[model samples]
Target: MMLFCDISLAARIERAETRLIADSSDASRARRGDTLGFALPYAGGVASFAEPDSPLNKVAGLGFEGVPSPADVDRVERAYAACGAPIQVELSTLADPAVGDLLTGRGYRLVSFENVLGRTLDGFQGEPPPPGVQVRRSGDEEFGPWVDLVVDAFGHADNQGVPSHEDFPRAVVENAIRDMAATGAWRLLALRDGAFAGGASMRVTDGIAQLTGAATAPEHRRRGVQSALLSARLAAAASAGCDLAVVTTQPGSKSQQNAHRQGFSLLYTRAVLVRTA
Candidate 1:
């Protein structure tokens, strides 16, 4: 039996690819005055930076190796200053450890932690759905509610910094939705009873489909809305020529339990380290 884990992994990667493709063109750099640029992460150790001084910062083809040393840190800081964007690096747990320490030593604060988890789907069996709910894909008209569910689910009253002056959460989500629409990279699905209950976004890249912006409405708890959404998304990925799907979450949270229910297992645990440089 081809392990379900293989399928799970492939779907996750494809979803990520879809995001990269969807956001590549409009990956705006941090604003000229804000000293920040948009950083859209991708696989293959490839990620991009954007800002007013993007050209000088060498936004094109900046490859992440192991943890960045002081010199590398200087290079990034210089890039940020030149671009008029304050320096903030969203380093993956997989980011070079040396770089993490260097930034921490410089006083960069840790803002958030994320975990990227995966599992095989070869022999996977989905859980039963709650009563009166059904799964369906979303389009432009339904996109707004989907975005709302994500913000609400994440419990963000508003994104406090950066994006408000720069390209913040709203901008990021809007840009993503636009890109997904343009390239058909997004697979938005809703679980509801003639109303919005829960939703998810699935995009593919490099044979891996990355899942993002999944959430249930505050009023729709414990009714299998998420489970249905997950099962539907995995099936969609398989039919859409994907090899696997990867979902990232904060480790040891309710979200992890949700992933487990959907047949996703631990692929790896990534840690986020930060400092004020």
Candidate 2:
């Protein structure tokens, strides 16, 4: 299938992602009782502060509205300033070109880039898992174990190709997983012969299925755990009436490789620009 990363499509995905970030901020506030953990609308997108040192402390969907005015950038910086965190602006390459100029003029420097991959889910029913692998929805009864396994897997996963730009601690990752589920993400678990092997998550909005993340335990590598989890999430999202499924991965990462094998194509790249406060 053919997919184009036109401005309109980029805007739609950006908007959805921005909204999810904003909702996650709200969830963080409720969970931690921190008043600064909130979201503010700016330049037709959102500037969210999830907590100190969080990657979510950034502005999303910036140029979709237009190149943000100097005042708009100042306002976002001030918001992040109050919380003592850097202002991360994830600008889509498909956004107005002028947006990059404005941000650089204000001292935001290129930090890293992440690729968004997408696939059409129209009439797509996912294939069954490989032998001895099982994928199923995670619920309250399994939340603790599921989270533990996810955290452990992420802590021990092998790194190759472009090194990761961000390294999150276990405590922060735990908080993030809980916040994601609180803000509408559906968690799934993969089992190898009835033993927990991996975990993943998905969030859908306006027919777009966001494959939030997935990770397999070090011992479970090459057992089809990640593929099973991805297929199960895709099937679930398609059945939920979603027409598209998207996942964001670091450049040259194994995650991107897996996504490519599953028919996901590059949709766009988000240029990460940061202004340290």
Candidate 3:
């Protein structure tokens, strides 16, 4: 059965994503120093600065809890400016029109859009992936390898799709993956013909299974590695008591296509608005 996604569902996913940003703050602080890793409360969400060029650098879950106060908005802008980073706000389209109006009035330009896809975990039994592809949780000794493979997979852009607004260096992606693991994400690996072919990760927040990220190495692409990894995560999530599983993908990208094939639905779209510093 398809799950009905109302504004309430969006709020839950947004809040869960924002909290992951807080975890990124902790991971950044551990990787760098106390001077960095700031997750400031803004409006009803958080303005997180895990690192200057971090994918986690953004204001999320805003305006859902409440309107963005002028004082809070000013403070968030100043904080990002101090860090020498652009202020990116991931605003749900379901948000009040006033929120977008306020952001545009402050000179934030729409940079891109990402779709939030989801499926309810009601006795979902994922189908077996294509032959030669196997999925399993990465053991502690395998975590380092997991990061390496996933980041490498991330580096090879999809041949076609709406491009991502931001791309970080390999080192930056590695750090972010480490930070995500520090925040309690379970690393999962996909093996093709008994070799390390790809990796992915997930974190459960408030009974919502947040599919943090997943990538298949270039050599292993088009072999159903990603789909297999996703199925493994869904099964694990359902077993862990999660009611909903969500993944954010570039609009019309291969990832979104794979998700759609695996029974996920488009729940909402997050408009990426930016104020460059």
Q: Tens-digit lDDT track for model 3 on 25-75?
A: 778888776666589988778898887688888888876877888998888
TM-score of 1: 0.66
Q: Rank the candidates by TM-score, best first.
A: 3, 2, 1
**Lowest-sum lDDT 10-residue window in model 3:** 28-37
Worst 10 residues of 2 by lDDT: 157-166
Q: Candidate 1 at residue 115, lDDT?
A: 57
Q: Which model scores highest in TM-score? A: 3
Every candidate's lDDT: 0.53, 0.87, 0.89
- Which residue runs of candidate 1 sit more than 4 Å off their true CA positions? 1-25, 28-72, 82-112, 123-128, 156-184
Off by over 4 Å in 3: none
Q: Write the per-residue lDDT of candidate 2 for residues 1-277, one digit (tens) a residue.
A: 7577788989999989998888887898889876766699988889998877776677888888877777877877877888788888889999888989988988999989999999998888777899999999998899999889988987875686577667877888888778888888999999998899999999998889999889999988888889889989999999999989999998988888888888899999999998888
How far is each candidate from the true structure, as Cα RMSD in Å? 6.9, 1.2, 1.1
Tens-place lDDT per residue, model 1, 1-277, is 2233343343344335334542543444212234244443333222234423221111211123334445655655654555455444445443335655666688666655555666544434455566788887777787677767765664432222222112245555554444344444565556667677877777666656667547777787677777788887777776667656678666565666777767666664443333222
**lDDT: the better of candidates 1 and 3:** 3
